[model samples]
Target: MTEFLGSVWWMIVSLGLLVTIHEFGHYWVARRCGIKVLRFSVGFGKPLWSRRDRHGTEFAIAAIPLGGYVKMLDEREVEVHPHERGQAFNHKTVWQRIAVVAAGPLANLLLCMLLLWAMFVIGKQDYSATVGRATGMAQAAGLQGGERIVSVDGRSVATVGEASMALTAAAMDRHDVTLQVVDAQERQHQRVLPLSQLPAGFDERRVAPLAGINWQFWLQPALVDRLVDDSAVRGVLQPGDLIVAVDGERIDAADQVYPAVQALGKRGGPGMIDLLRGGERLALEVTPRQGLDGNRQPVWQLGIGFSESHAPAYDTVLKYGAFAAVPVAIGETGRMAADSLGMMRRIVTGSASLQNVSGPVTIARVANVSAQRGLDWFLQFLALLSLSLCIINLLPIPVLDGGHLLYYLIELVKGSPLSERAMAAGQFVGLALLAGLMGLAFYNDILGLVTR
Candidate 1:
């Protein structure tokens, strides 16, 4: 229950920050354009906290953290006073109104770029796609284990994340995928493998499949970074002691240790844990406690934290100087943008599933996990999330920035605003569409939780 509440808290914080920033953009731009803003709200529904500034704009924090809005004075409303008509939003020039509408998404994009820049400047470690091992079963015939995949089809991959994405793109079509791999002996090999059968309840709309062989690299094991009183890990494993194995199985890599420990069931007591100290292996008992991953899967945990000193064998380290990171950050931002646009195109073409859409739950889990990892990881994730937010808001859907932009474009061409009845109809359609999309996203979230 504590962990669940913690997750909810993190979700609220993340959503609140992003939505506030987004709304601030509109508020700031509207004020700059000599428009009379009535209310600048963070979140939606009834305001939980509000203050009226000297300028007469109500600054508020609403109940729902899902989104926010900037309400402005408009003469189109029946309650508009004659004295306030000059400051109405509808009195603004078409360009000024467009600027106000465009500011929100632009702010999100800028925020993303800044976050990306900060992440690169601070330096975050990432694992390269250098393959360590690839197990061969009858399902994965014609591919040898331990071959490093350099590229899929013709696209060169530098990191594991990129490789995974490439595979997902290729997997959309039911076809054999070609891979370029380097063996341990330094020999490069080209191999073609057929796609494996997918699992049941696998929502293609929600997730893409791997196009090529999925490989795993070794990660450093979790060590005791911090200990809480009465926690299972503190009573068993101490700081400076390396976790060597769980359930008598040899812990070859850090990635395997956690799952191994989690897999151990209680036999009327705490499960046995093997540890390695200064060249000595010791046995200790630890009770497995339930924990949740980003996907909210129930896993066993000893309740200890890990330090950053343990470097895994498969890590291909790259260090960047502060000044040198600028170009890298720019390139990364561009790549992220391109990737996002490509995914959207794929989805529209029916090559990608609509299940790719993630709601607030997924976002929060991702943010929390990234925060746990490190500041750099968290910032990078935030940058990506910001970009996603910007792009999504810019989509030409009603009740969004893109929708308003479309309306402005029509006004520009027609030399007049859209009729009030037409605008109302558009709003109705837009609201319905937004509601339907939200429902689908929430449904997908529930389905994900159930399956996991």
Candidate 2:
């Protein structure tokens, strides 16, 4: 319950901040174009709080927190006084209207860059993209353990997070990617990973794992930190034991222990566990036990818990001075924008799964989790969210800022405004499309929760 409330609160705060900036973009541009703005609202529905500005514009916070709008004086929506006719939005030139409509998304794009700049200045700490283990396709592609990934498809990546983003995007589109990696000898090598070979309908969230790549920072030593109360190996294994081998297969990482034990359990026999304790090598026989996992599924267990203190420390930080970060931020924003657009295209072309569509629930949970991680992480999340808003709003759909811009573009080409009947029809179509999109997003969110 506490987690749920935190998610809701953070979601509201994130959306509120982004929406205000977006609406302010519209309001500022409209005012600059000599349009009389009647209401500057942060949300829809009844106004929860409102105040009249000196210019007679009402500033308000409304009940709904999902979105916001800036209401301007338009001759189509209301009667404008003869003296104020020049300030009416509908009476503005087509070019002026286009600018006003496009400003909201443009504002979000600017906000994204600003947030990324702040994040870079603060520095994002993460693990280096070094390979600790390689199997299947990764091994086939000559990705070796101890090699550090330098770039993916010619785009340099400094951290595991950056590499993952690039790799996932490419994987979604089933595109082959080239990796530049450096070995311990400081020799650089290039390898092509045929992500195009990945099976269709693969889970979007697990691309890295599915690609058979595991990072060094994730490989915990198979050292027993503690044992569960009913541990099957409690008598055979001690807390200070360093597990060396299981069933004759060498065990290097704690993650390797589970699959080894599960195989032992399936064989219906005792397995030999090799360990080193107090400068002595010992081998013990222990039978695997069936236990319920977090999802209540039956799984083999040795019932050993790894220590959090044993986890690898962050080895990389992406930081720059305020002056240096500006260009980096702009470059990063451009890269992100391109990736987002590409993913959208892939989804539309049926190359990507609709499961990638996330709604408010996913946004809220991610926001809260990111905020908890660190200020840099939260800022990065906000930047990404802001970028997404910019791209989504710029899509040519009715009832959106992009839709308005589209209509204005048509007016420009035709030398007159679209008839009210045509505009209304577009609005209805826009609303229906928007509704369907929201429904799909919600459905994906619910499905994710259920599966988790």
Candidate 3:
């Protein structure tokens, strides 16, 4: 219940802030173009708070926090008096109309850069991109555990998030990527991930696992945390003991201990368990109890609690000076924009899954999670969201800012406005497309919740 409230609160805050900035952009541009702005609203529905400016423009905060709008005086929507005809939005020149219509998306673009700049200046904590285990394609490519990823396809990456994004983008295109890695011994090597070999209809969400890469951050050590009351090693082992070897097989990782003990059970004999306890090395003999597992399969049972830790130390910080962060932020935004455009192209070409589309529920949950992480994380999330808003609003679809600009451009080209019938037809089509898009987003969100 607490989590639900947090999600709702954060979603409201995020959407309200972004929508206000967007509407303010339109209002500002419209006023500069000598147009009469009727209202600048942060949300829809009944106004909860409102104040009219000296110019008779009402500034309002409405009940609904989902979206916002800037309503301007337009002759098309309402009859203008002779004295106020020049102030109507529809009376403005096509170029002025274009500028007024384009301002909202431009504001979001600027906001994205500013947010990212602040995020970089504050520094984001992250785990190193080190591989813990390799299998299938990764193993076949000579990738090994304990190697830290240095770069992917010539792009340097320091954290798992960066590596994942680069890899996922390439995977979507079914393109092989080159990797640079440094082993634990500081030996550098080059390898190729044959992403092109991925089977048809592969899951885009499971990029890392599908590529056979397991991160070291998720791999726990071989430390014993708990023992069951009826456990075979209950007398020999205690909590806090680090398992060193089992039956002469080295046990550096927790996963290695299970198979080694199972092999001992298969041999039908007592096995030596070498362990480190209280700075002292000891070897104890323990006989395993063979049993039918949950699936009714014969297996050995150790009965040791091996759950992962709740907290882990962040080993890296992506930070920069205030001035230095500007260029980095710009570059980051450009890269993200390009990647987003590429994803759209892939989706249109049917090369990408529609599951990538997410609705407000997913956004709210992620916003809450990111906010809980730290300020830097939340800023980064906001930056990405802002950039997405800018891109989406700029798409050449009717009823959007880009759509208004499109009509103005066509008017400029043909030396006249579109017929009212044509404009109305376009509005109907736009509303249908927008509704379908919203429905798809909601469906994806619900599907995700149900699956989880």
Candidate 4:
């Protein structure tokens, strides 16, 4: 419950920051264009607090934090005073109106770039892909125990984390991925393995499962950063114990250990016993507990904590002054933007499933997890979210920036404004599309929760 509450709080904060920035873009530009802004709100629904500035623009924080809007004086409304005609939004030229409409998305993009630059300037820790140790039958796959992986699929990998990400991407498509590995003898070898052929029982927790690759990338153990009193792992597991195995299954990595434990309880076991306490190998048993009220569904619980150790160490770290960060920020932001556009195109072309569509619940979960990981992870997550916001808002749909742009273009070509009734119809269509998409996203979230 505490974790959930924390996630909700973070979600609110993130949304508030992004929405304020986005709306402020429009508000500032509209004001500069000589439009009379009636309200500049940080959220939707009823105002929680409001104050009017000297320019008569009402600045407000609204009840709902999910979104925000700006209301400008418009001559199209019957309530517009004759004297206010010059300040009306509808009285603005097409170019001016387009500028106001485009500013919000543009602001989101700018914020994303700035955040990326900040991350680059701060310098993030990097991990190498060398295996410090390897064990079990899987260890005998022509891989020297101390081999270091330098690249995958022709992409340069500076860290173990990068290698893992690249391998996972390759595995999803069952593609044959090439790896450049150097052994303890310093002998370099290039191997091509079909990622889809990776072993099924390979631990996904320690390293991402290669579709066909048997070699496991190592990760540091999970350390107990915090523990819930009601958590099953709390009493049974200690903070310093390095998880070795669950129910006799050799735990090769941190990711492998917890899921294997959870799977044991999920399969209707009372709980699996495990060894920990480092070299001492103390044995402990855990039990499953029902989540959320007496729902009677059992999940693995062991009241203990684990922290990661043996993370890859970087030899060189890059940091930048504010002035030097701009170019780096621009490059990173462009990469992220391009990636998002590609993914959207794939999904639209039927290469991706609708199930990939995530709503607020998934986003909140991601935000929580990213926050737990570290500040760098959180910043990366926010960058991706910002890109999504920019792209989605610019989609040529009604009730969005793109929809307004469409109207402007039509007016420009037709030499007259669209009929009020026609505009209303377009709005209706846009609203319907928006609502339907929201419903689908909500449904997907529910499905995920239930399945979990």
* Clash counts for the predictions, in order: 5, 0, 0, 28
lDDT string for model 4 (1-452, tens) is: 97888788778877888889889999999999999999998888999999999999999999999889999998676478888888999998999999999999999999998777777778755556776554332243444446777888787776666676666545444466777889878899876655566555343323333232233334565544556787876677766666677776766566676577677766765655555565686666666664543476554555454554555445434467888989978977775676567556745775445666889998888888888867776787787788788899999898999899999999999988899999999999999999989998999899989988
Tens digits of per-residue lDDT for model 1, 33-112: 99889999888899999999999999998888777899999877647888877788898899999999999988888888
For residues 1-452, could you state the per-residue lDDT of candidate 3 as single tens digits? 99999999999999888878887888899999999999888889999999998999998989998999998899888888989999999888999999998999999999999999999999989888999888899989989998999999999889998898889889989899999999989999999999999888899988888989888876678889899888888878899989989999977678888899899998987988999999999999888888777899989977776657736578889999999999999999998898889888988898899988889999999999999999999998998898899889988789988787888889999999999999898889889989999999999999999999
Question: Each prediction's Cα lDDT score?
Answer: 0.74, 0.91, 0.89, 0.74
Model 1 TM-score on a 0 to 1 scale:
0.72
The candidate 4 region of ten consecutive residues with least summed lDDT is: 205-214
* Candidate 4 C-alpha RMSD relative to the actual structure: 8.3
Best by TM-score: 3
lDDT measured at residue 432 in model 2 versus the true structure, 0 to 100: 97
**For model 2, what is the error of residue 120's alpha carbon versus the real structure, in angstroms, after optimal superposition?**
0.3
TM-score of 3: 0.95
lDDT of 4 at 2: 79
Give one digit per residue, the lDDT tens place, for model 2 in 371-418: 987999999999999999999998889998889888988988898888
Candidate 4 — which residues are off by over 4 angstroms? Answer: 126-190, 193-208, 212-318
Error of 2 at 204 (Å): 2.6
Total backbone clashes of candidate 4, pairs 3 or more residues apart or in separate chains: 28
